[model samples]
Target: MGTHRPRGETARRSRTLSGQIARVLPLLPLAHLDREFDYLIPPEFDEIAKPGVRVRVRFAGRLVDGFLLERVESSDHPGKLGKLDRVVSGEQVLTPEIAELARSVAARYAGTRADVLRLAIPPRHARVEAEERAAPVPIPEVQRDDGAWQRYQHGPAFVAALADGKAPRAVWQALPGEDWTLRLAELAATVVARGQTAVLVVPDARDLQRLAGACTQRVGAVVALAADLGPAVRYRRWLAALRGDAKVVVGTRSSVFAPVSNLGLTAIWDDGDDNHAEQRAPYPHAREVALLRAHESGAACVVAGYARTAEAQALVASGWAHDLVAPRATVRECAPKISAPGDSEQALDRDPNARMARLPHVGFVAARRVLAAGDPVLVQVPRAGYVPGLACASCRTQARCRRCNGPMAVAASQAMVCRWCGVTDPAYRCSACGGQRMRATAVGARRTAEELGRAFPGIQVVFSGGAEVLDAVKPGPKLVVSTVGAEPVALGGYGAALLVDGWTLLGRPDLRAAEEALRRWMAAAALVRPDGEVIVVADPGVPAVQALIRWDPVWHAELQLAERAEVRFPPAVRVAALDGSEEGIVSLLGLAQLPADTEQLGPVPLPASSPDDHEAVRLLLRVPRSAGSALARSLAAAQAARSARKIDAPVRVRIDPIDIG
Candidate 1:
């Protein structure tokens, strides 16, 4: 100890210094990487380098973002590694639950974890330019003598159980009309009143607006997160929820991820709408996301619509949720009187209503009565323009743009414009035949509106669709022509509704065509006054039309379920649609590890108007109910392997796809 050999030499020889010199800090792998990299944890962040949090690091000569998927005690390249720059934020953005959910979704969809995270959470650095104001007013307690509240009283207890963070499943059916929206608002309010957060998702912006308005009245302040909000405003709303300034969030599909503290409930309206499916990468559907959130947060989950989807029905049948439906008598009392074209006792002698018919007699009579009574009537059309497609007047050949084979629309000056590619041609001819004359075969909303204007002169006909028509619509005793999804009548209600062209809806080359058509019919029917009439212009013999005639959606759902069970369609057996080039698909089929007894329906050619194009073909696979999940996992794994092999073709796998042709 006397005259310890040079202090520096002793310090260097000490274990702490030697240990630091030999220590190799492990790198946290990013969500997306061809291979993991070696990174050293900086001494400053060593304590904070917990897995699942974001970290800044130098990689490939640049500082880039990365997620800490795991922490390791040592690295392979202990000598040639740079220390992590810093932890991005102390707050944990990716909780263990959220990380697992994203991972599961990525695996199920054959997508990257980063891609799934991108969908689940908004950009962390994107700041909303707004001062934190007072928090939104708490949801008001609603007291009602009606039986509706009798059910709502139990909502708090249900939500309290969910707050324990266990997936509590429940099915709620509202008596059609404003009541459905109100009941949902009340349930959300009860959750909020308990100092917990809530997320309410609807299928479309209009529905979001409606629900938001209802919630705003009951709950003093709420954040409406939707795509319609300009980027800055949307960011502000998102941040409000993130900062715990807003407890109630109402929005469309993207709002499922709204950061509501202490999430007690996650509710989705019309969970079956295809619009609820995110079109972006990872392609998570709102229903699936809601389910995942419920499971993760131990929140009460409720799926409500005017009519339940087969998926929802399956949930009830499987005992995953309780079916909260209005009593049969209550439903019958509120449902409108339904008239169908197929009623033999009241069949129209005039030309039988066909898919291509302009206006069915029953619908026409209803429209006339409603208009004459000084009330506005809604006329729902399947198509949206004056002429979405054109055919030859002489040879019945379809009119298509020669440039892109897109459907051509005729504008002023007799100009033909391709709706798809927007190519205009002054001189257009039918490609099927060298013909110039074109005929409009089917009626669209625009054409129907025009016809109604002329048929009922001085009656103020209004048209609504993809184009700007909301401003043009006014309260009046006239006809309101609209596309199935674009109906513009206000919430006050319409005198009557005419569901035209049932054949067009039922005959679609899609698996859920019937279900979708019935949903539309029910939506429009819900808009009519309870005493008003609903005329469905179709053969009452058809089960769908018959269900409408009886005003029984449950019957329709049960029948469809039975039929699907018999045919092994969705809700009975899990189905997957794999679409890709013929060769790629064939390879997938060849490599597929489907379970025994799983049926392979087709390598069927996709229906393209042209025969030369063979890039898209669909293979339908039906897995036994017990093996569906496994099959889906296997298909996703196979796709990932194919991608890793550097396959040049594209392969898409859709589980429980909405449309199956």
Candidate 2:
């Protein structure tokens, strides 16, 4: 339990009677009300109103939830101070370390501290708070293989530094055939062995399951805080970490803020996954949060993944972190043999239409060979469902719904429907050619599985994507179709893998197209056996394809970073995206008065929010890396100004948005 509360209330104090003042961060989410307010602390609740505890305070004539940041003997406020209504609970939920981190993140993202706090702290569960914290469990000494460590140039050194209780930051590229979860578990165990805490963050619940299982087997006990594990259960696990009962914590995005004392390491896997980006206020990315937490806590940091992000490359380029990558020989020895379109004249002659074919001859041959070998064949599709998009058969014009102008898609029942509005279009006609016929411009996992099942008869077809995501598939002569990031692990590794619809991902309008495509491809390819083959249905000349062929994601990241620097994009520079009504954006921009070198990318039109609503648009403001902080502050001030004046046309601000498309 926490600090004990008195049985009976003492004499109530007033603002004028006692000078005890509590600086409270009211849970008001308004931009103008982001700062703390001074509240008079009643003598009866003075002990519980200490820093980092939840407290209720009268704000704007009503009691509102707030956190007590600190208490002082006197306040400089000229106006009368409000008294704290009561302390919500005696448990200290927020730590000083996390408080500072929240402030830094808020400033960096041009968001209110209250918004970041909402993301950082879970909702109060009175019953869970009443329960006592768990006792500290002993650490285990599990021996781990050093083979994966020896593959990377600085892997051994990174582990050595961790053992010596020294902070070492590195961006690790996991070699193919490496058990990444087990490797991370071993790393966490090493830090726990030194009586220090380790926090590991992944992208989703399935990943948390794998890492948690591995850590429990290697380390003694770990607190797994997941988003889906009911609020009470999550709070109990979080309290276990906060009370220093668990030395290792493995979870998804929110776990980045785990309050473990004597921190030794902060690590994240797959920094480029879109799932790592939170789609809420403050809009923080898990990789950036993990990095910030590591920096503030002075703990060892590692960004381990099959493919690296441009942001991670920036860390290596700035010398803030070293590159922990395997040598070319080691990569080739561990990675599956990969081939792309136009790799050789013979391949080009054999599969001349490989780039255009959904399932090229090489891919079909590889899948067949793998099936004949009595091993699972993994076919990676880029989209989900039966067909993500449809086009006119006559003119190849993208089919769209007339009602909402949204893209048309085919349901599993073969009904044409609008993806956005969900309205069935039974009598669809092409706007370009006036043809009623439609064809699948892009095949999804289900469509691909249906086709492959026909081609490879007498073999079970397993589908993993959309709502029916399989964690792992049993190894056999079966065809496994999956969407990227949803590829199920095959026991003993896949015999062959086919990355189809490469052009769809590579040709996206987003600047991160190539980088994202490589990340998706490499993530699926790495699941193949060392001796297996990977066939990519993309042009071999593309850098992403070549990188996959050579299993060299580092080169791709470095190239991406250089390109971004040349063009002044994220990591090389900072961009703040303003998305909302045109008037709101214009008003915010005028009020902001951004720096001299700010480059305005767009006031491009976004779809109408509703028939009665104003047309929305997005404007991107770019500045030099050195001006990022200034930009954040300026935008925040402008937002606050608008809020203070009660402007109804609201503009949403996001810093370094993960997807600019």
Candidate 3:
């Protein structure tokens, strides 16, 4: 179009469109098209076609959206470059830092950069982009207070390091009765006080609200990033941070990618939460993302929680991060008085059948006393809903649906249904016992609440779990029944907490079962008053339960790391999951050249993936941590090759799959 350039342009020689050229990354899911495409910056868009801005360009035969990666003086393309169709926005939504982060994450997860950016940057809102952006707010210096951090041995030192602009990595194990939200807010404020920015990522919107409230009084110019915020509002808030108008960002997983400049710190609370694991392609964990961002930005990294995960322990073991924890004496003083079946006094007074008791003898006594004392009693159940479990009343056998052979469950309406196939079995008879009666084999929150209400007739019974989780419960002589991770924080803390049905959590088939069970137990226990009691209804001898009794999660975490390392599992090694039709997986494997010491496991059937997935299987590749990058490249290259060949049945490749059950 430029002056009707000579036909054929000297046999496809470049149609020179000045020296200005822009390299753009098209937002397409195809792995084969992962790299930037050279595009000519026409005179019309020369002023607004800067890097990081959104633009539309012609690719193949259709128009596609892309982000301007950078400008180059010349292009290596031998053919004529496609001029950008137009600039979508003059505003740079994708900050260079975030762009770099997305690239690093893509490489780490063996995913296309486009996919990571899709998660990092929300969809653009034309109206929001046109709105006047907020001016940068000056960060207020917070008075350095050792209010909460002083409880930990190196906590105060960590804060001081941040104030001095020294980057330190810490795995913080919060003590019982500790105000973790307030502590996280103070940590962000410490970095902000130094005129830098900080990011605090939690697991859910509930935590986001609490954290946001805590930061308002301490961390100035704070903005929240969450999925629940409407598209326009979320985009406006994200734009605020990108414009350098916010000093602190606090929200859920997405906040880990906040584009605040002058980065000082990145922290994640309750990093082990399953909610923090992204379900999309690449499947990045928020904690890992925080660690990466902190490393790239030279910012302080804090992984704070009541319990330590195996990944966090690996950091401490490798000397990559220090353990910030309280001394034994201080921890004990703040921890609730714990009672287990193994304790001598409790054993002497315990009922003979305490081993399988839903409410242990000591637990019932503690709950009664706490309720009588006018303080709330918190009962933590492992599962939610009413009658989530069903058993044969006659033979004491688990009830299963006749059609799908899946476990049966009864709803609150007193109707039985198959948990897996969704078939109603109102007139069901036990296959083994031929009995039409079903009993609750495992008690859920609703059933527990109903039982507790009957046990304590005069007390109020509050339910906090499922679709209606309460953030906080007022202190009073009430009984609170909740599922793990859904326990409401009671003002001044509950008088006592009873962690019931612990066997369900400990018996899960997932790799993180033991660690997760302990984490959930400790999180619930942490909500009790210092002088109050915590009674967990599980065998005290189990390592996880023992860790809770001693209030030393590091012990369990270290043990887990050692155990997993011996088996070449995660945190010590890297594992990737490849699943699809046997044909696709096998073809992909044959195409990829795996690194040495790559152990192949499985070819296991994935019948549960879908009813028609009976023939689909999953194969796992385990490799040494040092070879993770090479392994990712090999897998990604194989995927790209398959895509290039136009293979219809695609194999799903995920590095560090959420659960290897």
Error of 1 at 442 (Å): 3.7
Query: What is the C-alpha local distance difference test score of each model?
Result: 0.68, 0.83, 0.83
Measured by TM-score, how close is model 3 to the native structure? 0.89
For each candidate in turn, the TM-score is 0.79, 0.89, 0.89
Candidate 3: minimum summed lDDT over ten consecutive residues — where? 1-10
Q: For candidate 3, what is the lDDT?
A: 0.83
Screening candidate 3 with a backbone cut-off below 3 angstroms (N, C-alpha, C), the clashing residue pairs are none
Q: Candidate 1: which stretches are off by over 4 Å? A: 1-38, 44-53, 56-64, 69-82, 85-91, 124-126, 129-146, 149-168, 346-357, 385-441, 469-474, 589-592, 607-613
TM-score quality measure for candidate 2: 0.89
Error of 3 at 48 (Å): 0.5
Question: Which of 1 and 2 is the better model by TM-score?
Answer: 2
Clashes of each: 3, 0, 0
Candidate 3 per-residue lDDT, tens place, 1-661, comes to: 1111233345344545576888888988788778777877889898999989999988778888989988878655555667888999998888888999998998898888999999999999999988887766656668889867877897778889988999999999888888788898888888887878899999998888888889988966989999989999999999888988888899888789988898999999998999999988888999989999999889999998999999999999999999999999998898988867545645745577676667867777788888888999999997754343466666444576676444566655777776544567778887876998866645678988999899889899999988889989988899999988899989889999888887667655456878999999999999988899888887677899889998999999999999888767798899998878889998999889999889886665564566755777778889999999999999988888888888888888888876765
Backbone clashes, candidate 1: 3
